[model samples]
Target: MPLRRLLAPLGAGLLLLSAACGGGGEDGDRPEPRRPESSDPAEGAAELMADMSLEEKVGQLLVPVVQGTTAEENADLIEDHHPGGFIYFPDNLSDVEQITGLSNGLQDLATGSGAGVPLFLGVDQEQGMVSRLPVGTRFPDAMAVGATRDPEAAASLAGTTAEELTALGLNLDYAPVADVNVNPDNPVIGIRSFGSDPALVGEMMTAEARAFEEGGVVPVAKHFPGHGDTDVDSHTGLPTIDKPREEWERVDLPPFEQAVDADIDAIMTAHVFMPELDDSGEPSTLSENVITGILRGELGYDGVVSTDALNMEGVRQTHDDGEIAVRAVLAGADQLLMPPDVEAAHSAVTAAVEEGRISEERLEESVLRVLELKLERGLYDAEPADAAAASDVLGGEEHAAAARDVADASVTLLRNEGGVLPLEEGSAVRVIGSGSEEIGAALRDKGYALADSASAADTVVVGTDGARGDAEQKGLVADARASGTPVVVVAQGNPYDIAELPDLDGYLATYSSVDVSREAAARVLAGEVDPSGRLPVDIPGTDLEFGDGLSY
Candidate 1:
């Protein structure tokens, strides 16, 4: 097959502008990897595909988001659009029983639909601010896990997360964020990435991917090509990475490469624009040059290639929901995730196939990948997840213990000036900041005396997670330190928040405000657990460097 470029105007010149954006020929001619001799998922997928109608096949290309807290509430969308999969958000969740029932009911609907296929239920359970379901044991985010600097621990954490997700009837988890946080001011990727070092991020992502596989759930290593260097959040607007190709490969591509090599189930494309790959200013989620030319042609990722949620303003700003779904399919994305208008997107794809715009062969390729993922999770032969057993597996003693271990391993004691840490028992400590009430309560649970004011305290402990700007917190820290009382700055958000504060008597970063992370930080400050977390990303322009952590 000759290299060919289509100038057919796919979502604002996504097809026309890039010469390298060639939609590859059929898979029959391509050098695909061999499937295992045993009746592998690919074989099962092939058999299933043979029996699917054109509408059923086109439906497999879409994975839409549905509103509602229960399966019955969401069943109409599934029954009407016939989406191959569903993505859940916190708004759609209530509790373990509700979500578990929702997943089971969705699968039942999908399985009994036009093609009788099981739905691939997925959620962004990245374990920190992005966690959707509230039933699982919450661990610290990716950066905190990276601070542990132990790939084995990272793997264990992901494995435990996978178990809880599977028990809830979810077969897919979008996690172990592969973006390397190279920019300190990066609006979205901070603390979500493993670190600034590409190699370390790569290693940690691989470990997490392997662990997810071990736990019988498909893991999606996401925001591919990368979202780390940009300061704009894609949820609001498109972010552009203006660096050269070499710099992108150096900083953003390694973890995704490693993930592909590790046979990750999926690599989700970011909504950011990489002009180095495609100058059309289209988000990578709709750019064939980035998805096919780079991810497929260069990296050789044969697994499912999913788009980041199509509803995000990054991609949505330029294209309507229907157009976004069509262009993403043309760009070689195997899954269209969370289109804003599911009905419009589904109808558009069905029409594109019927009008000879998107080739049936092309539709088949993506459907095969989608079905293979479902078959890999054993959805065909398996029964709906045991919702009754969700209580036994989620947040159980073992899961809690594992969370505590990871949390304890990830506490970074950034500054301990004048040996002020390990405060004596019953020391009068004043706690303040966002979530300060919870942090203070955790301290009280550990037998620390709470002080009413900075002037009356032996020490003032300020807990913040950058949820609000740090200037106010910084002023409070400065005033507390000026009063001649010792001040302990507990960074409950990004550790880099320390750079904005005055030098203090003690500094600690928990990298998250999750219950487990907060408890671990409390124990560390109370002289119980050791502070062992190392820095993943450096505090820009500060003396701090990656791998910097102090212990008691």
Candidate 2:
């Protein structure tokens, strides 16, 4: 389990892959890949690809989801169709032991199937709200991490999260959302993003990318071309970013630039439409001008490029799953994630190659890159995820303590007028609003008194989820303020909730609803830790800027 540990560019490795295939591209004839002679004594990483059939090569492009939890439920996918990997969801997991066993079973099925290069076994374990694993160290959102203004925290979050993922038989993570959350109203990318500042997002993303890969997991920085400025959620519908090219260059493109410069191994595309970037009106995920021209040509990202979930309504608008797969490859994407019908999509790509619509060189290009990633991350020589040690390694005390430390540092005290924070020890407190029970329990665990009535309490603590919008939260805060006791609001969802309730005597922005965030907010309330975090994003209705926050 040394992991081979190559945390840098695959420059020479890629050159060898191409050279082994005898060099193929638009510039010259890409004849069939040749095998080394008996006397040649030289073989390349792509030799497995060269030996693969068209169906096998097409299947390698797909990273689909398994039907149910067990390996037998979708044994056909691994034992027959031979998809390059799988994306695990909550339904596919129960606990560390079950997941480890499932991962081993799946790998066993795939070992003798197709070209036998091993599955990627990925999850959306971004550590915060976008997590899929049943058990792991729970950390705050990217915005919360951004609030800490510490790249090392981001690195620690990723490195530790990666260890747990590998222990549970997962290798790839779709994380470190590189998108700068410029739009406060964005339905999808709010807490998932770093913040409004592209520079900050870039700094955090580079740190995370380096750490996750170095930790033996292939990290994928996601929602490329930036999903930040859109008000619509691409999962429900296609959102358009109508920014001019200049604004895109200033706000959305810098983090991706930093990622490429940092030698990131993979980037997942946004399904968002950029009218200025590609006037033809295709979303960035399917636009050749955006993918091949901008991401590949402009930013010079040489690593693997994957489309965001194809089953989502955003990309499914123009084409069916089959055509979308064809178009994504034509647009220069190397991986297709979450296709509704993997078999149809795989068949479509195979037909595209057979009909000469997609050159053999083009298909091999992605296959080799896919294989190279497997080799680079030590997946090529990997065994089934170790079931015995998985339970102990995952969600251990050290990782939880690390998660709380990050949450503690990310507690941004946006407003503390009249010094209404750091509630007195053992003072009766009334906690209400979203996640009230959990927040109250966390406080009680820290030895704070919980009052049943506001009149009996020294302070009234209210928790709120402002990410869904803040209208009702205003009323809840107004009611709490009416109590004779002092009012303290914990903005657990979005920090901008503070702006909605200007009357709050005390406000702490946890920026997430994760367990550690709540515990950290409890610690902050109990005066165990200092509120050291600053705002990572600007408040929409308030004058507070990105770096504004107060301490005890």
Candidate 3:
């Protein structure tokens, strides 16, 4: 059958829904919506909600991950289940053109729902290791921005990310991680957070959140109630936080509170358990006291509440997928993100309402909240994104330059003993580490000579990151130092790499290994740009505190 013919019945259902009570009228057809055509989002949502069925309303509470690559592969799910939103993973994307088509197709399918509301297409474009989009400007991570101590740079990064997201038809970005990384040994959220200082994290995150809002994307301040102090990774097991309320208020809660005050439209809950907030030992994603009592009650956040992916072991290990969905909604989350089994989740939510375990009114409350955000985002009136504009909008020269500037401003001179940096242009330098190849290429492109081996070099430039604590790399640096050759260490991950090798002649920390960051480190080594960034976190057991850096 033809595509339009296949879609006609679905479109007809939305067209015939009654304006007052979700059924056919006296003449066997529904009338148009009767509310005043004003700009009030609540009034608009209420008018639409009056016409939706119980099954349709429940669907609006879910933001499931898509399982298919094309519209035809997933059209049945969208048409039957009516999920409020969808989040993309790397698996669902191919290129800019494919992503644009997929987004437009999903929105087209959404228009066929009884409410005709647009879907909230979200992606984890956090830019460091968590970036999801296949074609766009890739910026440095959160710590890199924190190292710069310039909120405007953070805002610029978010704004550029938003532009690329919008061009590909995404309406929301799960980004601007507000967690204050108090524990340097934190497994999952190491470089994802802005910094350890609550005030500084708040300042930087608020700037990015506000920028995302202004740039036409919904900003999500994530891992609410704070995921920074914990050491366990939520993806594999639950991390427990035992801090008292006062301690939480001091270190963890400030950044999220700052984000909320900045008018962030959504906040993603963490899967980590905070025993002080709720004694039940459930992760925050399923804790009503944490979600309803703390974030909504104490924080006064009236925006949409999104849960982290339900498939993670932190939540999945404790409950069935269906139960996890039901519990998350009852706990006050407006969106059930990335449920492991979408059908099972839908069935369980439906059964809960049918069995009186969940009231119809309670379901409606979350559906209303979801619709309000959609209306506020202008999803009701947005046109299909232009697929042809993807190239023009993404990875442009302006964004590249912005990323380079941010990288340049974020390279800190952690320990420049004897002023050994600003290496001579023709000096034989040996580069090594996780980003050694990239760093070497960038430096050679800038007129620096890379020696074939450390022994043949006048100076050795070693690159290190949080991923590897390679003793072999340390041995090479030590050998260079022992030979009376200058050893310049570039930290491309956690700045603590310097503390691990304390005997270096010079040290620089870039806080990230993104292309721009590596290039910035190269330029600094070749005397192209002076080191200007400060340390965002402390190098534990050393006197190198936060905000410590040196310039040429």
Candidate 4:
């Protein structure tokens, strides 16, 4: 039979799959059996990919987000667009059971759609503020983890995390942020990055990728070639990377190269524009010069290329829904990450094919890659995991214990002047600062009481959550100094607030106020863990001296 004639029935089957499964390709025709003992998963995947229609293949390239309390809302979106996958957010999760149910429900929809391939479930479970699994252990932020500078530790943490995700039937974890935090004032990448050094970041990311894959999950190394330097948040607006292509090749591309070398399953494109890298006047997500020309063509990354969320203003502001989808495809992105309109994306690609803009071959190439990834991950024959099993996997005791261990190891005592730390047990300690509740609790657990005022205490712990630096922080610091109590100023978020309290007896920068961070701070205050974590970024001060904390 002619190739065109063979594709006709496949096209009809895809339509039926879309209509029956509600858009997720869940209701497509059953996958054909391979030779029993066919040893190669890729061979099976290629065979399956050959059987899909253009529409079904396109459906395999989309991953969408559905936000509602229940699976009903989630299923509606899955059925409507038949996205190749779904990314879970905090809202989609409540507890382990809820998350399991959510995953199972999605799988059920996929099975019903007749699409033999399993849907890829992805989440940004980076341990701190970005964690989506509620019941999962909340580890320290990436910066804190970086403090340890131990790839073994990072891998161990990721390995535990991956096990939990797999239990819930989620195959993909978008994490191990490879962005080097060179800019201290970086609004979005702050603390999310492992550290400011490219070598360290690359090492940690490589370790994390290996750990995740070893634990039976697909790890996505993301925000390539790097989103570390931009002060602007891509979620709200477009951020440009103004460095020359040579500079990027020297600095930013190293971590991505390391990740590729490690055989990471996916590389997510950044939303930032690097005109120096690509003068196409498009963000990296939509620029073929960046994605294909630089990343794929130059860097030799043949794995799946996923775009950062298409809904973000960085990408959406410049291109409409359909145009963004089409441009990303043209740019060599294998997957459209969270495209706003699934139907429009599908239609746009179809239109592009009809108009001879995107050749059918290109579409097939991307689809085959997607199918290969699914098969490589064992999603083909895998059944919807038991809800009970999922509950056991998410935030299980083992995972949480690992998180606490990493968090405890990350706390650094940046500066402890005049021997103010290791506060005497049973001492009268005055906790006088906003968002010091966690620190205070840690202090009290060590047999310290909150003094009525700074004057009545043997010591005062002035902690800031790094939320604001208005009159409030300054006033508290001043009052503590006036009370004659030995004050320990701890900036729990950014250390910038410490400069205001120049009169403090001691200073510490925890860099974050998350649970693990608080625990590390407590340990450091008690002189338990040596403050080995250097300042990943410079803390500004006239007399503080630049590069004061850099190890090298």
Query: Which one is best on lDDT?
Result: 3
- What are the runs in model 3 whose C-alpha is more than 4 Å off? 1-36, 467-476, 479-483
lDDT of every predicted structure (CA atoms)? 0.80, 0.81, 0.83, 0.73
| Candidate 4 segments whose C-alpha is farther than 4 A from its true place | 1-38, 67-80, 393-396, 467-471, 495-503, 540-552
Worst 10 residues of 2 by lDDT: 1-10
Root-mean-square deviation per candidate: 9.8, 8.8, 5.7, 4.7
Higher-scoring candidate on TM-score, 1 or 4: 1
Candidate that would win on TM-score: 3
Write candidate 1's Cα lDDT for 1-552 as tens digits. 111112111211221111112111222221121223447788878887876678778788778775676555655565566678888888888887777667766655555445667778888888877788867788888888889999987898889988888888787888879999988788898888888999989999899988988888888898988999998999999998899999988888889989878888888999998888999889999999989888999889899998998888999876778888999999999988888887888889889999999999989999999988877867665545665688889958998999889989999998998888877788888988755777789888877889899988888888777833657777777778788888888887788777777678898988888888888888888889879899998887589999899988
lDDT of 3 at 428: 83
Query: Candidate 3, residues 441-499: lDDT per residue as tens digits?
Result: 98788777889887788888888776336778777667767877788888888787766
Q: Per-candidate TM vs. native?
A: 0.91, 0.91, 0.93, 0.88
Off by over 4 Å in 1: 1-38
Clashing pairs in 2: none
**Which candidate would rank higher by TM-score, 2 or 3?**
3
Candidate 3 TM-score, true structure as reference: 0.93
